[model samples]
Target: MNVDRRRRRIVVVGGGVAGVEIATSLGRRSKNDQSMPAVILVDRDSAHIWKPMLHTIAAGTRDISQQQTPYLAQARDAGFEYQPGEMCSLNRANRTIGLAPLHAPDGRLLVPAREIAYDTLVISVGSEANDFGTPGVQEYCFKIDSRLQADAFNREVRIRMLQSVAQEQDLSIAIVGGGATGVELAAELMQLTQIAEAYGAPALSSRIRITLIESGPRLLPAFPDDISQATEERLESIGIRVMTNSKVSAATTEGFELDDGPTVTASLKVWAAGVKAPAFLTNLDGLESTRGNQLVVLPSLQTTQDPNIFSLGDCSSLTLSQGERPLPPTAQVAHQQAQHLIRHLPAVISRGKRPPDFNYRDFGSLVSLAEYDAFGSLGKYGLFKGTTIRGRLAQLSHAMLYRSHQARLYGFWRGSLVWMVDRLNMRLRSAIRLD
Candidate 1:
């Protein structure tokens, strides 16, 4: 792999929130400076979508077509080059990354493997659900770890719902995990009955059995204990069976088998229990990595083994101080890291300046349970310190996370237009995907 020497090149592997954000920012800046770095964004997928919103797509609460932004269009608008392929290997000494071939839906190879040279590399490959080697999890349980998985889940949901209604039988859905994704997904599935009723199947909600299983003693162990208790109460109140302290030892074609005793029976099973970085990130190309496969990075977000190669998002592990816990894998942390790099990388790349140490501020966490309810905790701050909120106000705040990300990516005016379009679309379109 080789490139023109007139300008430095920044290669961003993985087009997730962090990767895309940094690439777009640096790429746009390059438009003004003749010596500015050329940005090349490589991703496995052809488009981008907020990873947090994947569960919504899985539950048919969102339209994938509208939510996704084509990588080509984003690159054209933000002044970057988009390459389609998944990074297969990183060659640190050679300053290049080998990418896998791109293939069509029909399995024909569209582009052959190649290596891309880079002066600087940013890896934000993100994380995926870890089944912890549980038996049958990979074979039987569905996961909403990517857009394609979410789309497939949505199609399965529509088909299953239709079959259940036609057979006049209950559709049992068991979700393993009490994290935000699993909990929020349970809520969204509840909304399906309402959608069905509106479309013809009255009282369909009663026929859909959803059970949420958690190994921990409580749900949302990361949040304050009160939120966990309240969330369980809320879910139970809405007929969502919450099973705590129940470790799923195995997932079968029928459902989850608990370690201690009973087996939960369900036609559809989803695993959202935990997450770990992609296995390849573990000591990848001689770079250090965590036991969970997250890349070990300096506070400045640079990989410990090589300053030129940086990592962020769920794939990177960093602790602000020794003995302290590494930053949690969340959208907020990824966004802040991307912003920190965006703010300092220009000077760092061009003037040989030392990038400032990355400091992450926890703004708190929010959980929205579809239209039924929402909850949140205001982060460590002033009068609002650890403040808790729920209901409509909380729901609105939860919705703002994606909106703010949209505003950041599309600027204020266009983002506002998107918000308006979403509101209009909600009223004019079916609340659920029938196909």
Candidate 2:
């Protein structure tokens, strides 16, 4: 069972922001140097989309076809192998991982279960919404965590919009979460109503009701108090009902039942309240994990159970100081962790050096609410508080974050060209996907 270690391989599980970036970065190095380890990225999906843009996709604010990058093409360009399947088991002792059998959409088996040997492993499977065992959530509520889920929501929204126009009824959507995803989606749904009207639909603005339910005191709770307040006001300005301190007891086909409150009735409901790593991570063959199923990692991003294995993004939990609280499961944290490994992994894999600790720098957060409004908290730890941005500037900065990610994946010049094409496409193509 001793697989050849002559050509070392680094198998990265999950094609998320962290996993893809690490694969691309390490793959490029091995492409240039023969001694570098081979890079293999494993994922269940064929494409990679920015996790932050899922809400937009669900709302049909942006074109999903253009926003998503095919992982096969990316792997080819970055000089890595893309293995399509989910990680089902980990053989840490054997330095191997097992991939679940691949199946076609029609339930046909395409590939049998297989195992890949790796000298080092990186787990970045990301996370999903935690419904907190709320009854009927899985059956009655929608989630926008993955691209498939987003696209499904989009299709349903388009159908509902048409039905609303025909019946002259209200199109009501209830989102149970006031975090960035919930807040941003509420805004985008408002924009969708407007866009639908432009495509020869009825005067739908007045007929669409968007309700955002938050268990906390305000929306965007991670942002500063003022920023959260401003976002709430902006959302209200757009006709979205903001329900604060309303905890959902369960989601039914009719709507969300609130604890100690009335049940908000709506056919289309979304659960986006809290986040937890995939349940599979908890059984990652004895890896130390949090109660929420996230792998507990050191500052160097190595799992406490095994140094040869590392984790990042939402699926990995790390706290720099004792009792400081684990870092938020955010795109910012994932990007920083990916870059840290990209820079240090080469030396560790090729020259056998100890991986350096990853220090996260919070450059602040920005929330862009479609074309309605935007807000930002710039600088580290408030950056003196005067660095806050709002309106157009904040929206622009928010967009640049996605562009920077593209630049990293495609290289600067190519990424710039892609951006230019997107700008031009906006002018020529329909803003919403009609199909």
* TM-scores of the candidates in the order shown: 0.97, 0.97
Q: Write the per-residue lDDT of candidate 2 for residues 1-435, one digit (tens) a residue.
A: 111358888889998888988899888888777788888899998899999999999999889999998998998899888888898889888999988899997999998999988999999999999999999999998999999899999999989988999999887899999999999999999988888888988779988889999998888889999999999998998899999999999888889989989989887999998999999888688899999999999999999999899999999999996438999999999999999999999888778888988888888898989999999988576435548889999999999999999999999999999999999998998987788
Q: Model 2, 233: alpha-carbon shift in Å? A: 0.7
Please give the lDDT score at residue 34 for candidate 1.
58
Find the candidate with the highest lDDT and give its number.
Answer: 2
Off by over 4 Å in 2: 1-5, 381-386
* Each model's backbone clash number: 0, 0
Stretches off by above 4 angstroms in model 1 are 1-5
Name the Cα RMSD for model 2: 2.2
What value does the lDDT take at residue 47 in candidate 2?
95
Score each candidate by Cα lDDT.
0.90, 0.90
* Residue-level lDDT for 85 in candidate 2: 88
